[model samples]
Target: MASTGERDGTGGTDGAETAAGTAAAPAERKASWRLVGPGIVVAATGVGAGDLVATLVAGSRFGYTLLWAAVVGCLVKIALAEATGRWHLATGRTIFDGWRSLGAWTTAYFAVYVTVWGFVYGAAAMSSSALPLVALFPGALGLKTWAILCGLAGLAFVWFNRYAVVEKIMMVFVGVMFVVVLYVAVRVTPHLGDAVTGLLPVLPDGSLLYTLGLVGGVGGTITMAAYGYWVNAKGWTDSGWMRMMRLDNRVAYLTTGVFVVAMLIVGAELLHAAGTAIGSGDQGLLDLGRILEERFGAVTAKLFLIGFLAASFSSLVGVWHGVSLLFADFVERTRAARAQGTGGEPPVLEVARGQRERSWPFRGYLLWLTFPPMGLLWLDQPFGLVIAYGVLGAFFMPFLAGTLLWLLNSGRTPRQWRNGPLSNVMLAAAGLLFVVLCVQQVRELPW
Candidate 1:
């Protein structure tokens, strides 16, 4: 995939020595269509079992009325991911670096946020992945045992592998899960007419707050911020790759849209029609599995469980690699800022260019994500920490959206690459939407 730089005859050495948080542009080559990646990584990482459950619940309560919301959610994420990749390629900086450049406040919040969020999330991810395994094996191992094993496997896989290996595995897992969900959606024999109408914007009675979560709250988690890091890891560090990045970003969310739509269809046809209720989280998928077994037989149920495993494990490994990469970049940017503060030179070594996977920060965060959260699996998550995590996690999307708006519009970005009118509108809308969700979530949290 030749970048725009290569095509335009201005390739700027492929992000060789770009600094962490500087306003620099690494010359790029024009993007080739066939070499798209990173999107899969973001997509796989974004659509965890929790997300699927949310979509399923939306379907169960309202049928296809909120299908439009699912599609809009995909569009919102597409804009966010595109802006993220654009910031990285247009200005040769990592997302963490961009956030740092805005001020110390961004970094401080992120430090606390990632630390708390990762500890809680690691436990959640492991347990989510472990759910299917326990169901399929029928008591071969306890939930905590399976959860620990899942966490360790993800840690090991990401610890030794590079971005290329990670992307390929993500593609395979996402691909399999998509097919599985699509098959189930088909098997359920959805109300085709209702689904078509669902494409139109319409909200059912009393589905406001609950539906609003799906309506505007679709941009997954920190993985969206990690999109840029993954882009650099793909070796597309200049504006030349902008076209490919946009296309790749679109493909990512479209795949996500299809996945969730299929789940909604299953919930609408299989569960909603009979007024069936399922658990609201990972156990939700297990409930669906039980229903599938009772209705369709063991084979179908097992297949769905396998799909659940794939979806969960892909997220586990993706976070292990992607977020660790982000944290590594964070450490690099922080150290560089400190050096500059002390009248020393901050390092010019950019992420993804110097084998960042081998870096200490990356490995440290990986272990931090893997081993530290195991305790939460054995015991109840502390109420105070959970509340803190809830608040931080809720506010992160808005923080990211607001900062992207600031960084992309300011002098930090080149004149030619600055946010256009459409970009501004979309980003502003995203920021406001996230703020509303944040307020709602905080209000609901058990403070």
Candidate 2:
């Protein structure tokens, strides 16, 4: 295998020509459709039920006035994803390692956020995944039972299978959900003039915040940060894989962009025209399904529900698996430090050898996300937990963008792979937009 540094063209102990010579043989191997794996899964996983609801509500409330926002969101995600993949390929380091370079502060923040975020997210995700199932198969199983089953099934799927198998499963769900959503959008047949106007790039009165939210919300989550790990897992760790990575990122976000645009069309033509509003929670999706039944008939409603179930369940599994990897990586790093005695001689050799080994803390955090949060499904989540989730969630996008900017521009990466002027501009703009949204989130907090 070509070392990551050589593949990235980041001249180190090895030179570029030698790296290229090693990678050239693999480069000649014909690329297959099957290689487009984890990117699609990560993208599909990132755009969950909450994202669907958010986009739908935006369309219903603002019509296609925010279509541009959705497009912008896709662009921003592409930039972020590409940067992340670049870091992995270039530095031969996972995103966790990249973040650690920024400072201990970054790692510390992520440590707390991952734990708190996973616990709450697990229950919420499983419950949301369960709602459509409960609606479809009433009395067959209680909601909590279904939720637990979904969680366990997801856990099992990831625990046993490797990356390629999991990617195939997620891609199937992505296809199902994508087709259903596109079909619904086609059924609605939104106004061309209104959609064209929405593309004109102007935020209307009283719509600035909604525009920002729509743009920022487009197919994003902590899992977006997980893209690098997925790429690493796929064995795409060199600059030779750069073209493939870019292609993967492009296709994933293009699909996601289309999905969001379709939802916007549904919102604009169906809900907005009918003066209908989706409710605020996962239940809101159930309410929308009923409305679809009334207007379009039972088949259409069922299809929509299927799409919802796929979206929710796929995301449930996606987060369960992807975040677990991240948690594991975080814990492994922490444990290595502890094992070496802080002020004593470093255990650099042990840490290096065990860098990829799974740690107890990783599995512990996974269980933490999967089990303890089951109680919260029955009761109100603690105020502190909710507040922390909200705050950390808001900060993630900016944190991701800013860190990518810093890393990509740093001496750590090869100059050829560093952010070009155009990429930097897009990333900087994304960073600014996310910063503004983060401020809004903080300002709007109840406390």
**Leading candidate by lDDT:** 1
Pick out the ten consecutive residues of candidate 1 with the lowest summed lDDT: 3-12
What is the Cα-based TM-score of model 2? 0.90
- The clash count for each model shown is 9, 1
Task: State the C-alpha lDDT per candidate.
Answer: 0.83, 0.79
Give TM per candidate.
0.92, 0.90
Model 1 spans with C-alpha error above 4 angstroms: 1-33, 342-347, 351-354
Instruction: Give the total clashing residue pairs for model 2.
Output: 1
Candidate 2 structure lDDT: 0.79
Measured with C-alpha atoms, the lDDT of residue 378 in candidate 2 is: 89
lDDT of 2 at 299: 95
Tens digits of per-residue lDDT, candidate 2, 8-30, equal 11122212222222333334223
- Residue-level lDDT of model 1, residues 1-447, one tens digit each, is 122111111112222322222445445666665787899889888888988888888888889988888887888888889999988877666777667666678889999999999999999999999999999998699999999999999999998888889999998998889889998999899888999999998878888775667756543789999998888888776777888899899988899889988988998999889899999789999999999999999988999999999999999998999899888877876776665564534445433353678999999999999998999987899999989999999999999889888877776666677789988988898898889889999999987
